[model samples]
Target: MSGARHREEDLLRGISASAGMAIGPLRRYELPLPRVAETAADPAAERQALAAALETVAATLESARHSADAQGQQEEAEIFDAHLAWLEDPALREAAEHHIAAGSSAGQGWYAALQAEIERLRQSESALLAARVDDLRDLQRRVMAPLAADAGAAEAADDDLDGAILIAREMTPSQFVAVAGRIQGLCLAAGGATSHLAILARARGVPCVMGLGEALLSLTAERAVLDATHGVLESAPDAERLAALVAERERRQAQARSAAEQACAAVITRDGRQVQVAANVGSAAEAQAAARAGADGVGLLRSEFLFLGRAAAPTREVQRREYAAALAALDGKPVIVRLLDIGADKQLDYLSLPAAPNPALGERGIRLWQTFPELFETQLDALLLAGNEAPVADAATPLQLMLPMVSDVGELRWVRQRLAARAAELGITRLPALGVMIEVPSAALCAVSLAREADFFSIGTNDLTQYVLAMDREVAGLAAHCDVLHPGVLRLIQATLEGARGRCPVGVCGAAAGDPLAAALLVAMGVDELSLEPAGIAALKAWLRELDAAALAARVPELLALDDGAAVRAVLAAWLDASAPRGFGVMSERRGHTHNKQ
Candidate 1:
């Protein structure tokens, strides 16, 4: 021990989840559910107690919302509106009462009601609603925390999570919400950039860096400097380094503001190639933010948000109205609505799916359509009516319907046939242009035949990589192998592009499309469009504007011949280091980076 050298600031590099900087002590956050009994002596008293707890939660949300507004955190504040409304919802109130009336403790009844509501919402086709499960779960945990005998200790634990840089292996969206605005920064050992955790973090302006390995757990230093812009973590940074990073943080914020101001302008390459830059949004709030970010159109409109915090599937009218609102917000721009792609990562609890040993390969994507055709059918019906509504879609491009998890021509054909039937049933002559998500490896491999049935193709690189590699990225142990840059994954992309080249417009809407290096490769592979979160549009546009697609296109053959993702990444990195514009600060890392931008 005497001869051992003491390291000065251990450096940990990770993927940038959000852009910002923080200097604080590292704190770890962990929460476990409390055990509550089912029986109670006074049902009415239990119900009353539950109501009071809900009131407390409401006050908390309202205060946070107002704080967000006053601090100029409009989007972050808007996130609480739904939570506030959920508090007043009669249905939610009744569910908890029903459980209490059934002779359960107030805590147990509330927990049961919360679980029921989550299940009901989980079945929703709206992407926004589906994403709310975490928040709802978080709310449930909060209300039940103090119900235990150690309520005081639990509250103290919650308070301790504030005012520190959180270092975690993973955090759910709701957990992130609990510490959202209060935390200085966050570093996770695992999580896709496009995961809900990342999105929620960005909403609150909390800097996050994810995908660091387990080595992050070994750091003992309390004080550290976090630079999310570069995904760097420095333990016990010296004065000079800290000063430079702090200054860089200020410069980046200014750049972000300037970029947002001009986000609406068309993205044109230096050599004159105009590429369509659009936003992949789930909620209406995000849609508006996308417009402010200067998105050409909504490349992905997730349908699951409508299902959160309630038990019933959203009525057709509700779905139509929500879709209409999103379109109206986009002004006359085109919007591609992806049908509920729930299953696997996002499960529909109400479906009562049996415990599967391998859910990832089980009923997910198009496979869900087989077991629950009625759900997709109802959604399809809504899409037809909504698309045909005059106020919903003006002279702009007609709203497009996209089926997730289409693995073959047959699946694509099934939806195509169903669409035709739905249009006829609704007495509609014009049908929305149909598209399929090429997320499944089989779908990419069979893209040629699918092109004949579908009008367009949108590659979901995240799932495609997972399915092709047979590795679930959600599992922390397997995250390293779930990369989209692998040679096999890119080959599938290449095949899909080759098959759909002349037949339909092929685009990528996954997190990978947001990466500057991967975006270049995607362009090289003949992708006609790239969609990502609106926050990344300005940076990606700045980076893409410098190089010619033709120049990158010439390297496609060589890229495809690479032995592995590492080689592919290294080659792309070298190319960028040699060719990327020096003007945009678009320097590539030594080996470049991959993984979808969350």
Candidate 2:
């Protein structure tokens, strides 16, 4: 239809939620909120009705949680957990009760209670907190649906949006779950990278961009190009522009396919040094994607996904199945499973640990594990059992267990004791290789001592940068300051490498590993492994084949002496420009300073 018209091309920029490119017809999707009517009611009866509606909604959310988990959507299941927590909040119930006592009906009281909280969240200083308003609204709708006089009031038929990029002011998880597989792409006028919708979009591999603002509403294009990688949407493109986009898309696809086909091979630099390029996966599905993308193995397997969203800690067999399935998906590739890393930031209702004023700087990761031995012992048992049942990987690619947020060698030693004890109890002869994640400044500073105990070391640059700069990654609009390329952060990385001192494999499994400039720098710094997102694997591999790692190693001192992240970026950009043949289009095109560019 777009080809039939001669329309002017217009480009709109927004925050990218997921990375990919899609061209399709535009379909505006609008989900109507369930309405509640004001009515006179007996206060006591209204209170009872409110209680019953809350329980019903809570039960529905619990059911959805189980269903999502069954379908391998652990993240979506976690969203329901948050909703359930809100549903049972005593303050919310008391607010509705007060309204009911003041003569409002149950539906009206509940609506008012939720709206007050939503408004408060919207006014919060933290953008991450404010972005949760849609989640609250979703709760409002679920509860109101059961409370509405007409039982079928909120029921709506699914739209035929297949092969179309759906645009909305904002979307709730409930609406997204219903049509996630049907939509080709997604565009939102309002949402940040931390929103539940954005998480779901990324998990589903949907090409999505959000926070497009009022400009999105004015888009009248019948067909458009959604380049989520760059957060650009080309609307109402003319024939020439459309053809160019189509060609570009095809070329990118072909390049990706070719790179992936060659990715499984060992990555040996021109100087005859071999480096492992791996993936950081959270689920079995992700592991399969990594294998397809030609990842050497999985460097960081986030085991926390299994623990979250559930009422109790996952049983040994349950965690074992999930872990084993992930290993099986990768055939014989190695997997370094990080034990439960939850704390105040990522709390489990079942685990009652001491309260901390600052969750980030307080009891978390290995500390949390130490505080609750029973919680982590089961996971250790699961890992041991999984390795036994899963496919036997290469001797060089043995299964590994990693400890998170370990600031000292004492914590690593403690975990090793527990893991060894668990393996013995499980009658396993050989223990899996144990490692530590160098996410904290203390850990990076003491990497040498940790490497003496740890079988390997994985640098989590995202957290390391945040910790080094005292900048929280969740704080919106601070992305520029929280850059991993900062000289201080790079110096810490250099220290980590020096600590390893060829004693063990030191890998970076953070944002830096996926970034072309950072990845190149890490390779030059003598990092033995680089584990990144699955999508970035192939392109990085293609680019690495053209790199002279030994030659780049000579330039490391120059980078380490750089004043700031911008200067470091400028230098890397120049190097990329000088090496024209090695310019992998996807990696060379920098996405610096992208707001909410998750």
Candidate 3:
């Protein structure tokens, strides 16, 4: 047995929670509660304790709710508000009291009741409700942890660390709220990025790594370094390693600042070609940040947030206020708003949707809008009001309307007609430039026809790639096929661009636009604009400036002749590498060499 095998080193890995490095003392937060046996004797005392516990939970939730409101995290606050309602529920309270009276310890009784209620909720037909049930179960575990020992007290007492690593088997949203900005990094034994702790980490910009197995058990309160970039957790690092990590961190931060500065600068090619570099924002705060980052305009303003949680469709006034806030934050910059794209994947209670055997192929985007004509009308009215109210000096601010999931020219015409009707009702002579997302293969195939009816095109690569490959991106097994760099996907994009040439503006707003190599290919394909995350804008702009579009155009035929996406990527990479310091159009030497092989 000894000769056959040996135990491997115990190494743990997990999804990187945030995008930075941090070395800090471990601060384990364990919730506090009394022993089960201690509270069994006195029913009245147990009742009082339960009431106090419920009040404490209410207070904690309220504090979180207020914090979220102050920070303009309304959606986040809703999660806490739901928890508050659960705590105040008469059924839940009665169940907990009954358990205590039946001789269970106060803490155990409360936890048991909550867990049972959560389980019952899990049987709910609503997926959102099921997700909420899971959240409640997590909260119950946190609320009862303090009962185990004095360890909970130590965790609660750790409110003053300079930099601390939160070690937990799993953390509740409320627990994370309590620690808030006090911690630098978080390491969890279990939990995925969708967990409340991970969500909070992302919102707060704190470094975190979860699903570290039992690594949290081995960690000490002493300083430990977490390299989120490489998914490495270094325990008790020596001075040299610590210094190196610190220096590297500083360098990365400097790079990030430099990137931000560069992102705002004008995106002019070396040969004097100008292209607008904008942000795809989902919220008003994001819009403001993107504008500050030098976004020429908002290429895509998602309207899902306004529709997500409401019991009924948002009124025109409410939508107008929201749209106005987003436009105002942009300070008159163009905000290209995409009407609600919600459907099967993002089901909303307000909308009556039939269950589809294949939702991806079913009604979504413009289809959903077509089905619910009133919703579309309300949205159009709000957009028109916002546009009219916007300052006249920014009249040419390019507030284009884009319809999502438009698979054919007929869909485009239908939407345009509706848009015209809405405009007539609003006493407007003409509507803003209307566009269609070239997401479906059918749209790409018939781009010219669609472009004839629409004023512009924005490629929604996320859905485009999914549809082209017939693969679900969220499914782990199909992730490799989800690559936007695939030759088939590129061909679709090229076709779309070719179809839209000279007819209307063509922009790539999907994740592919952010990739340097992919952006080069898009430019080579004659794409007019590339909208991406703020961080990638400067780098992309730099590459675009260096690129000789004429030279790239000369090489396009050779690239198209290639059958494989990987091969095409290789050829592009080689061309970029040979072109040194070429401006925003320069490609990596490695990528150029790879492409040359093709």
Assess every candidate by TM-score: 0.79, 0.82, 0.75
**Cα lDDT computed for each candidate against the true fold:** 0.73, 0.79, 0.68
Cα lDDT tens digits, model 1, 422-540, are 88999987778889999888888888898977899999998788778887554444545566788899999999998897899998998778767778788767887889877778767
Model 2 stretches with alpha carbons more than 4 Å out:
1-15, 22-32, 40-103, 113-133, 146-169, 178-185, 211-227, 231-247, 388-397, 424-427, 580-582, 586-598
Every model: Cα RMSD to truth: 6.1, 4.8, 7.0
Residue range 1-598, candidate 2, lDDT tens digits: 1123334347777776777778888888886666666764589988888889898888899999999888877668778887897788789999988988988888898889999999998876555567788898898888878777785754765565888888889888888888888888899898877788887887788888887777797676667888786567778777787887777777777777777788778887667888899988777767877887888989888887677656678898898888888888778778888888876356665778677766678888888775788888888888888887766545443578888898899988878887778878889866788888999999999988988888999998877888899987765446556778888999999999999996888988887787777787789888999997777787888777777778778877898789988889888767755764645464542234333321
After superposition, the stretches of candidate 3 with alpha carbons farther than 4 Å from their true spots are 1-59, 69-171, 176-200, 207-250, 393-397, 534-598
**lDDT per residue as tens, model 3, 1-598:** 0011212342345654443467688777665433444357888887887777677767877888888878876546766765675666677778888888888777778788887977775664433344454467655754554443442544445554557877777666766766767788877776544345554665576777766777676667476776553344666666665676676567556655655567667776655667777777766766776777678888888887677655577799988888887788877767889988877456675677867777767887788875788888899998887777775553453467888998898888888788788888889764577888988899999998988878899998878887898876433334435667787888898899889888999987886676677777777678878887544455566567666666777787788788776777777777766764632322221121110000
Rank the candidate models, highest lDDT first: 2, 1, 3
Which candidate number would show the highest TM-score if scored against the true structure?
2
